[model samples]
Target chain A: MARKILRGIPVSAGISIGKAYFVNRQKERRIPRETIPHHLVAIETQRLRNAVEEVRQGFMDARARVPEELKEHGAIIDSHLMICQDPKLVESAAKNIEERAITAEWALERSINAIGKAFSAIDDPYIRERMQDVRVVGDKIMQALIGTPKPVDLPAGRRVLMAHDLTPADAIELELSKIMSFATAEGGKTSHTGILARSLQIPAIVGVEDLEDSIRDGDLVIIDALKGLIFIDPSEDELAHYGDRKYQFEDYQKAIVKQCHLPAETVDGYRLEVCANIELAEELVQVKDNGGEGVGLYRTEYAFFNKSNMPDEEKLYEEYATLAEQLAPQKVILRTLDVGADKLLDEQAMLDEANPALGLRGIRFCLRYQNVFRMQLRAMLRASVHGNVAIMFPMISGLKELRQARFVLNSVKSELDAEGVAYNPDIPVGIMIELPSAVMIADTLAREVDFFSIGTNDLIQYSLGIDRTNKHVSYLYQPLHPAIVRSIKFVIDAAHKEGIEASVCGEVASDPYCVPILMGMRVDGISIAPQAIPGIKRVIRQIDMEECIELLGDVLTHATVSRINTKVRKRIFKRFPEELSFFASLIEQDDITEP
Target chain B: MEPSGENNSLEVVVCVENELGLHARPAGKVAQLAQSFQADIALCVADQRADAKSILDILSLAAPQGTEICIKASGCDASEALEQIGQLFHDKFEGDT
Candidate 1:
């Protein structure tokens, strides 16, 4: 007889056989109330102080041990250390022990809890996550005061980390090679731990509330991280099935990579430009590795985020220069400072509002913070001297924003000249036509800006007033909405009429089903996520522009979602009948296609 | 500026300093805030008033730095809401603050 194990949701898509490493807990014990020797109180106080210092040093050393890529989060850990060393927390604990005659452990817990309550009162989620950091440092301090070290064991061999929840420190300390996967009982989509896990490419399953209690040590487990599914101890047949599935997935990923260097053309010989959207300079390697034509959009906001203060012009210059150098000749369109509702700059920006998605953000934010925006613009201008760097402004609603953004660019260029910094004077400036207003005035904006990019993500969100982030209303966030299609079509036409290149760098552009519509609209180019490049190209090659235009004509008149979906599906099925049959056969035979 | 509000509307004036005045993000914020109340809200610039609840309408105004704009709100909570909205402009909507 074989035993089975049950656990949390698996976030990454893969199967692996590995050992289990149970997370260790720090020993917590209450000090006896009877231990109050008045003379010893001073010694105990001094001992606690020393212990706090030791823990603080431990945290600092731990931060230093983190990889350079992850060192950006050092400020978060430092903030946590301050929470531990907060005079208010220390004084209250000491007062409680001396006056109420409470145990040191109890006194510490109460004091930390009080501080945590204060943090909880903050309306911002970013600030709220900081509270957890405070708790982590406080817990370590308490452990140190009690003379207990939180034990962490790095298990040998490929092992999955099984825990209730992982702190940011826990994630940073993880040895990449030994870890096969990770599953936790608590965490959300935006947790730093989860983000780190994805960045490390480690399979992870989070938010499995009862996983800690259900699995025993040494139990066999299968984690399918991509589908968020977890399988406990499996039958031999099940194990073998997953083993094959794992190999197939790896092979598929390799196949996608192999296709990277190949031109994104269909069997019929239609070529389409497939570019990558990069967040950091390091990600340029993946773009190059994948044979991306060029970077369609370089999100500059990431440089400002995950830090205490704004990055200065020189700091930003270095970052942009490196990226521009790497992707030289191939253009990099840098979208300046898209921070707003979804990404806040500071605590005060995260004000309580009826709707945050519709709040001040993107170019609007950059405009408000001109000094910061100008620094970014200056950095971008300087980087342009290194390579073909183009500038783009996000969330342009009309001609005014576009004109104003262009005006700032001119000023930055002139300032760079006065300072004798080498810069590109003719760097093409673009606007992201993401709002209906921008779409309506696309002709005017296209004339002013050098190029136009249709940001379908926000275009659809604004056109429908449906918050894509909100799960309940996300279903209504349809990209193929008649109004959205018209808006995109309008921008594309407007850009073409003004002789400006137009491309789309939205999730919709990557969608295979929507490629035909994009082609029909006569977009100059389509920029998609790196992963979706091959499939989108395959779709593009199979269909002719004339046929796509015909399909669009039929699609534009459909009133309901189902009607539009059916029409598009029918058009796609007609164009790629063979591919559809192949897919159906593959699905029938294997029950899954890795791609 | 002439009153851009409808009948029985409250008038509140504010100055624009956000470089890309009343553009996407800020316009979206204003729209989101304006939609919260039962009253209809509108923003005025250079004798033009656009619905505050409509991002397209607000953005078209193209209000720039040092531009004086009037906010008008009508219906329930219009007076209080107009004052609150006026303070957002006075505070520059927390931009660079």
Candidate 2:
């Protein structure tokens, strides 16, 4: 009989069935603080140096293997190289070895902590995030010193990689064609390993504890990343079933890839617009390939975060213009730098924010410094001339902030007009209905803006008083809560009442359970990660508007979140049994790790 | 302020005006400049001090925007070293004016 399926948090989406290849990194954990004999110190130090060279050489090899299009990621490899070659790290390791008589792995840990102590007093969240980068560097070096094999070079056969944990540096340089998927016992969905797997379209599952103990080498593993489940040693019937399903999935995916160029309408002829939310310009190709009709959310802060110098209007214009021209006729909603909180800025006001989520951030931060805001507005305006573009403001609490933003946008527009810049003078302006206050007064605010796009992530956070970054309170950040559905209903109803479109650009928009409910809500559009386009569209095309509306009605009538959640899941899964089954692992995943 | 003549050293304090503060990339630049000068250089944030030329040490300072850091140097190039590091902050470590 097949062993009971192991459930884990799904980090990336896909399906793979292959022989298991286990990579044990347990030694790094087992001897975190080991002591060395005094005489062995020299040998340990030499070992550390050799490990550094080996890791450094690995980076050099990885860099050489990286394709030209992915050269932007070469900067990450370079950062790792800098950490490996850093003299302080090397010297500190040597010092710890000679003085404390510790193992190289133990020495590296102590050295990292000793360095981390200096950053303890610093208040900048952005700088604080760098502490993790240092930790990653330390771990990478230790992995090298331990001579852990990455299994990067897999033979041309179906293979499933099982690791205790995998880093970006280990995963990025592989010739990924041979490897079918990845399952790890550790890492979050947004970890570099998970993100890289998604970008490469590789099937990946993380947080699968004790995978090495149960799953042996050469075991046939079925990785259903969509549902975040991996089936081990399946029966012959299951294999045959999966074999047919895999074939259909690939053919369906290929068909959907071609459908990007087609209109995102339902089989019943219900035309619902689907767009892409992009972090960088390189993703434009992915967006296009995924059949995105337009750019929904252009995260401008990424451009600001990556550079040392303040991103001037010209630089912003060039970047925005490139995106606009590429997706001409398709609208690009450029959100002005939504910095603060996790994202840091060079400005004092942003730094001074004690609670960035509720402080001088988003639209509030923009209004604080109109000159900086003006430059961004000017750049956005300039880019609009190149193609169809729209402006959206983040974290709009009330009409006052929205009006204030429009006033500044108008001023920038006037300045452009005087300068004889040709732009879409009547470019559509929108507001992200993310705040609870905005949801309450959506009727009032909807009358003022061109459109309303619901940002469910922050909306839920503020509504439930959940600090998503705080893991303890994260369970409270429920997307299917009765409150969220009602809020979404309010905003969409208000937008419809005002004769404007309402769109969902949050994580929930792409969720299978949320999709039918959103479609039932009669949302004009949904914007999601490019990779999710096909799967979501497949769900959208399968259901009728009447059933969706009925499902929404059933869900909203319930008082508790769990009640509504169960109802929505049952209704949607009934319509998409195969599709939801594909993503079933994540559904069975007891609790969402995301805040 | 003029250089202190005590042991031919110089001590000066300057606030980081850069919006991103002195992060890793800019810290790298500062560390490189510190290595070029022939002086006993150190940067102090509050009571903590980091060897000016070590990138890891400088980054550990975690000097956010508007953090006033103290630089102390004693050598023939004390004043010169202080001025250059101070100027990097003043210019926001933005390569071009």
Candidate 3:
């Protein structure tokens, strides 16, 4: 019999065959804000408190079922419960309800909204995510007082969870063992739920449009995570074919792991460095596991963000030092505070602008707040004492910013000297060639800095005049645009001409299909997310640099993005037909099998 | 706690015993205490924070383990906060041992 198939957003890395289990999106009901009678306020408050208690019991039960590894997160829920029961929140809601003669639900909702809005306004994603914790607390209180349905547990048995979005709390509460895979109707690959799925190594797909109504529970499903394909209700022949392919894919992944320690060299003998772009210190494990040469780009902003206050120098130093030590001998290139108009430092630092991407951010913010900049510089410098730590400044427009940054570095050195603390005075400094102006003056900046790392994500965005963060303009943010490629080539050539090392540490570097083009550009290194390292290296090892260089030379002359992309893809397929054929064969084999 | 010294120029150097040192939680506590004092309080760790009043300045000190820090406050309330801050060090800043 012919089988039916469904498509979904691909999030995680592997394929799984499971029964369809729909994770119903919890409906959010907005409570009225009007006040209620005084006597009823006391009654409603008691009712809300009782409801919160019930939800707390449910949370405890959920925690009991979670694996021992995830018990610490349970503490976070406990703290959230505390916030729900906080005398401050309770009393304020009670007072508001009594004075305004509002329903207990309305008063509680208003109080929670105030707290959630306040948390959301903070400049940290970690802390901002805590706003959801506040919502969970309110949801519990509302459920208790207003009789809202309790959050249901994940469906039992092997299945692929389909949902609109899964919060961190929601993800933590899921029975992971029973979940074969997950597909979210909405969410980017960097969302907390996405990260959690990746960490759990579950097959997941995100950003699928209208995925909820298309599939129903108990439907047979096939998820091809590697290719970002989902098949629902397939023929028996297709299922058997995919089952064999899934087994082969698992073997291939194992082979990559075994080859992790091997050099990333093309068939003809050109070697390349495959490094990882690490966001959190804990992610360092993945880098090492993947046999990354070192941290190509350590995003340090995550450490300082999502906090109640600025991370003091010592705290920053310790975190940096730990990463440096862990990657000892291997270099850790730290990109300094990249916050800009999009990410405000505090409410006081807010500059409401029509466009934030072009506004003051990156090194510009550092220059304006010399003290804050100095603290980061000092921390980075201090951390250098532990291992090979290099510093890179972001968003340089011209020579003035680089010179001023150097001046600050010198002043920090003098301070460290006077204080009798040992620091590496000769620590290498680099600049991110993201801005068009930076690329234009790359030769000059290369002369001033120790190295250059092209942030293709921003380079493509700025070169194309597209704001990557803006959903409306996201469609235009193509990395293969010849103009963007030329801009990258210009900076790479400039850095080389000045005898400075250069590398690409953006989303483009992580793409397997783009590895040949990057190699042809003759960039010194490629830094990508840890998970992409092995696959990227595998692609890198299959092609000759000379052929890649020839392909790049031909593609560079193309005028349009589609033309450039077509030429690149054609050259890649022509040069590595075997690899392309393998991938195609895997696509043809449509069965899901357990690894 | 009050400083025993009669001289307003008295200064004491102490080591931060807390695992996080004088990070946000401790720094905020110190800043709050400093606000109460009428003295021109300056915290010096290493060569930084020499002309302090800036929380950012004190933080840049990056004083870690085995590091010595000096707390100097010069007015009437200076002695009180300084004494309390010094005692905090002696008390190990309520740190886990």
| Model 3 CA lDDT for position A192 | 46
lDDT of 2 at A193: 62
Which is the leading candidate under TM-score?
Answer: 3
Each candidate's fnat, listed in order, reads 0.00, 0.48, 0.00
Off by over 4 Å in 2: A1-8, A15-224, A227-252, A258-260, A348-353, A584-588, A591-595, B1-97
- Per-residue lDDT for A117 in model 2? 78
Residue A583 lDDT (model 2): 58
Best by lDDT: 2
lDDT of 3 by residue, A1-595 (tens): 3254444434467778877776656553323334455667678767666776777787777767777899767656555544555544566677767677777777776777666655555553544555565677777777677465445555457778877677655665567788988887766433445556765668787766556656656677787775556677867776887798778777777777777767789989999888888767888888888879999888777655546588899999999999999999999999998875345566325666566678778888789888888999999999999999999999988999999988998999999999988888899999888889998989888889999999887787778886654434555657777777788888889989999989999777866557677788898998877766776788887778888898788888899876776666666767656444334211121222322
**Cα error, candidate 1, residue A116 (Å):** 16
Among residues 3 or more apart in sequence or in different chains, the pairs in candidate 2 whose N, CA or C atoms overlap within 3 Å are: A227-A583, A227-A585, A227-A586, A260-A291, A345-B19, A346-B19, A346-B20, A347-B19
Q: Order of all candidates by DockQ, from best down to worst?
A: 2, 3, 1
Q: Tens-digit lDDT track for model 2 on B1-97?
A: 4344456777899888877777877787777788788787889989988878777778777777789999988777888999999888888886521
> Model 2, range A1-595, lDDT digits (tens) per residue?
3574776657677778888875555542333345667889889999999888887898889888888999878866765666666767878888988999888877887788877776666677777777776777777788777565544545567678887877654564455676789998876543446655765677898877678667866778887776666788987876786778778777767866765566766777888999987767888988888878788888888667556678888898999999999899888998887875555577844367667778888998899989889999999988888998999999999989999999999998899889898878888999999889999999999889999999887888889997654434544657878888899998999999999999999878878888878888899999987887877887777777888888888887899877776777776767778766555322334543210
Which TM-score does chain B of candidate 1 obtain? 0.82
i-RMS values of the candidates, in order?
A: 17.4, 2.1, 10.5
lDDT measured at residue A267 in model 3 versus the true structure, 0 to 100: 85
CA error at residue A167 for candidate 3, angstroms? 8.0
